[model samples]
Target: MNKTNSFRKTIIIASLIFGMLFGAGNLIFPVHLGQLAGKNWLAASSGFLISSGLLPLMALIAISITHSHGIFELAKPIGKKYALIFLVLTHATLGPLFATPRTATVPYTIGIAPLLPGNMQKVGLLIFSAIFFGIVFFLSATEAKITDLIGKILNPVFLLLLFLIFFLAFSNPMGAAKDAAFTASYAHNAFTNGFLEGYNTMDCLAALAFGITVITSICSLGFKREKDVAITTVKSGMFGIFAIAIIYVCLIWLGATSLHDFKLSSNGGTALAQISHHYLGTAGDALIAALTTITCITTVMGLVVAFAQDFHKRFPKISYKTFLAINCLLSFIIANMGLDTIISWSTPVLMLLYPLAISLVILGILSPLYKNDPVVYKITTALTLIPALFDMINTLPEVLRSTPLIQAILSYAERYLPMFHLGFSWLTFSLAGLIIGLIIHFVKQFNYSAVED
Candidate 1:
């Protein structure tokens, strides 16, 4: 019972968690928030932090606390078959469908797109990703020092360069904040926009998948006990939030200031690149590109490694090498898809998957506190998932609303739920409904399960 061990473990685990949470997408969301939030930066930042800062970190803490092996374990309390469905959906989300594809797309947009022609952009993405995952496969092949290279050296370097941009922005504001895009609804809308922007970050959902890797990394540093791992992850994760929040605040500020000088760019990368060009001159854009490419590469490496590791576990007969090859190939195909298409197509899937992902994250950290109750997990998941469906349908207004089944669900949600038009209102209702459902579900269970037969 060395209390000191827990403290030491927390620092180690958190440093590792920080590395996981801070990645390529961090560069994207804050800039957009700053642009759209314009004069309403604080209100928008509030919403941004809830989804970007607090929710994902909460989810990570939950994952470590519950000892979920993957997304599947957190969902397993509902039923094995249902958990499998959740597993496939979560895997597809972080894999080729959205997140994995974005790794290739975002870097190209920020790092290469401005330099290339419209027709050449897709070719650039395909080529960059091919090389990107190839390097990931090579680095992941060895489990020893290279992981440190990525988790430690390369990542810190990425943060440092980004921090320099933040520092410059801080010393000199880029421009004045403009009127927010939807000013009439800006106050309430900020939160919903923040929630959706959080999706673009994609780390929270990825956190669930990477949660166990974090636990193992903690144990490897020599904190073996489960209690120690929990304490360590929570503490370390808090430290990470502090560091990331600083960067987020800086980027948002940069975005807000830019409106003083120019109309907001249609794409977020444009806003970010503009900031770089103004502050540092011609070379700064290239400097930003170099850092971004590095960030994207490291993330792809980590994700592919995590995915391969999980696949091998499910099929023990297949060696890790084989799984690694399979992962790289799948990622390569998915990456070749044009950048604009990935960004456009990902919205529906991201909306559909987020609440479910959010639920797993919350359930994991809270599980240890709850004695891993199957009834509690089952009830809460069911409650949370209902609104996520609506969120998904609403993302595709023309296609989804036009469909019969979706029209039915959209009708039901709109008719019954107030503020349904507000972005992510469904997330709020579903989470609220879950809390309420759990209270009733657990009390009923206590009466029936706890009463002596």
Candidate 2:
């Protein structure tokens, strides 16, 4: 490998990863955590790094090492039928069902909604999402050009504007890093709360989906071997991780320290708006609007391309353009549900999908130890689904929640399952399944050796 060429390819691939990973939610979630975590912001953000920064990085590495064509391939150890179901559900969640729509909503909520008159807010969002996703759809239609469009062009513009905002906010300071009162949610186990909060960004889930795109970009740059692809992916990911970490820390500090001089808003968007106004006035606000819009567009483009490419390959009857069109349209309609509605509805689904996604990634990393056994994957995932199902039901509305059947199941889980109250019941069951799987594997091996003798 030519050192100079490899370095250049790494920068571009890294920018592409950063662009895919850094969406509007990335902007909002950290700031919100900082504000809520208050004086404990440092502790809380340390937890946030686990889910947001670390897990996503690991997912990227796992995908590249597995040489997964997409999420389906990454999950193939679980068996074909299960892999298809996982791929469909994961892509749906990452695309129209949740993350994709949020891309349009976040920019509008933070950047555009505040600018519109109160009466026009609803109409403003509709028009904005339509136009926002329209541009995303157009860009994503030509999926092959994604690396250049995002990595070389759009990401540079976004970073320049973001850094300017960061510089201004730091130079003036929002207020002293005040000892803020912890919110009820973060009042206890603030670190864990922050860790959970990072889940809302869904970066770990998206990283797996986006990994195919990263691997393709690397191969395009001439890294053809599986080992080279994995190595280069990690090196490229370091660039994106550094950028995300610096930005997240800055945003969290901004939120944590803003309470002394600025009243906290209902959400991260409002808080960001107030801070921008305080520092840069209308000009600063405009810059924010531009930064958020660009970031969201790039993210949406990545998502649309990822979903379309994977689904199109799976179902050759449907063209990539057809799926891209469908995803873009669905995302536009869902996004118009408004930011609050989208967040509320998407939260439960995310809670359910996250544990499963994390389990698969971890299993993939540990595959070597188990010799990539299908039995291990099946047992672990099957066991995880029990608690994961209950977790989803717990997020349902009062009408469904009031059902005796639901209550009975939840009560049983809470009583029998360790860490149920803390939202990690799946961990216990998953571990048990792993142990069972190992025993079965070893016992079967012993029997086979005896037959051979």
Candidate 3:
């Protein structure tokens, strides 16, 4: 391909990456973090960028370096059974159980729910989600060019609307971001708090699933070699993530400045609505609602299709359409629990899954060093899993966390694990696991070579 054509294709791929990963959680989390971090927004956003921005790019590179077809293949070195379990859990979290459902709830919470009376909000959500998923189902069932639809059409429109909001906010400032007061959680450990808050975006998890689509797109554009594909992925991924990181900073700054007029919101959706209304009134609200819904539709369709296709491949007896319907139906049911409830429940799950996912990403990236050995994969993942479970238990809702069994587990973790209170106890365990696994791998290699001599 010519340089001009190659550059165009690369840009298109970058847009696709941005469209796929920047969905409901991406819209809300940074704004909410800004509100919490207040004057410390810069410190907090740096941490947020690591997990929400850099990690997703790393995930794509991991898939490319390993040449894994999808999430299952990415985890395959751990063992087939473990790969299957990880695949199911990752898809479940990304699909009906959490992320997909949140797609429906976030737009409703931001734009639609505020217009309704208190009692009508629940019914409004039910009606809105039904229509939302109905559209998703129709689009996914068709053999449409979803990648082009999102990258060429919807993402640009969403960006235009979002940029308008940002421009207006910056032009007519609510207050200086540095002048905003920090919430108690962010007062002392804003960076750590922001790091954990980044988990809410779920982009890291989505990156693993979306990696195949990106790689395939690059290959179709005449990049036949593995090295070329990996390089292209890195180029496109950097562009996509750089865009996302910029938006995250802007949204966080918007949130911090909005504190001049509005109090801390219960969630980012609420904060976004308040800001929109303050600047543009009903029109701003409508624009934000449309922007959110458009971004979310792209995401929900992607998640549903990915889930159905993967599950159908695993169980050939089930049709893809059948799996699609099941996912949509389950997501519709869960979305009605409302945005706050979904977020509250999803946190513990993210806490549990992130460490495992991060470990896998690191392992995949470093697989070249270990020669993709199963022994290393098994050891690192096994050690990571233990602390991950504790992280989950520790993050559970207060009511469930107060139970005797859960309390006992948290007490033990807090006492025994470093950085347990900061929600990074897994870091120590994962490092230890990797060291031990590498030592064992080298020792085994040495023994076999000696015997051969």
Among these predicted structures, which one has the highest TM-score?
3
Candidate 2's TM-score reads 0.95
TM-scores for all predictions: 0.89, 0.95, 0.97
Q: List the candidate numbers ranked by lDDT, top first.
A: 3, 2, 1
What lDDT score belongs to each candidate, Candidate 1 first?
0.72, 0.85, 0.89
Candidate 3: tens digits of C-alpha lDDT, residues 156-273: 9999999999989989999999999889889989998988899999989988877766766677668998887888888899998899999999999998998999999888888998
Model 1, poorest ten-residue lDDT window? Answer: 178-187
RMSD of 3: 1.4
- Runs in model 2 deviating more than 4 A are 397-405
lDDT of each residue in 1-453, candidate 2, tens digit only: 889988989988989999998989999888888889887888888888888998888888777666676789988988888889988988999899889999988888888877789999989999989888888888888778899999989999998988887888788885665577567777777888888888988999889898778887889889988888888898988888778988888989989888877766778887877777788889978987998899988888888898988888899999999999999999888888888888887777877888888888888877777778889888988998888887777776667778999899889978887887777788888888888887887788889999999
Greater-lDDT candidate between 1 and 3: 3
Clashing pairs in 2: none
Residue-pair clashes per candidate: 6, 0, 0
What's the distance in Å from true for residue 121, model 3? 2.2
**RMSD per model, one decimal:** 3.0, 1.7, 1.4
* Candidate 3: worst-modelled 10 consecutive residues by lDDT: 142-151
Model 1: per-residue Cα lDDT over 124-228, one tens digit each: 877888887777778778655434766667777887888788778778875555544434555557766666677777777777777656666776777677876
Total clashes, candidate 2? 0
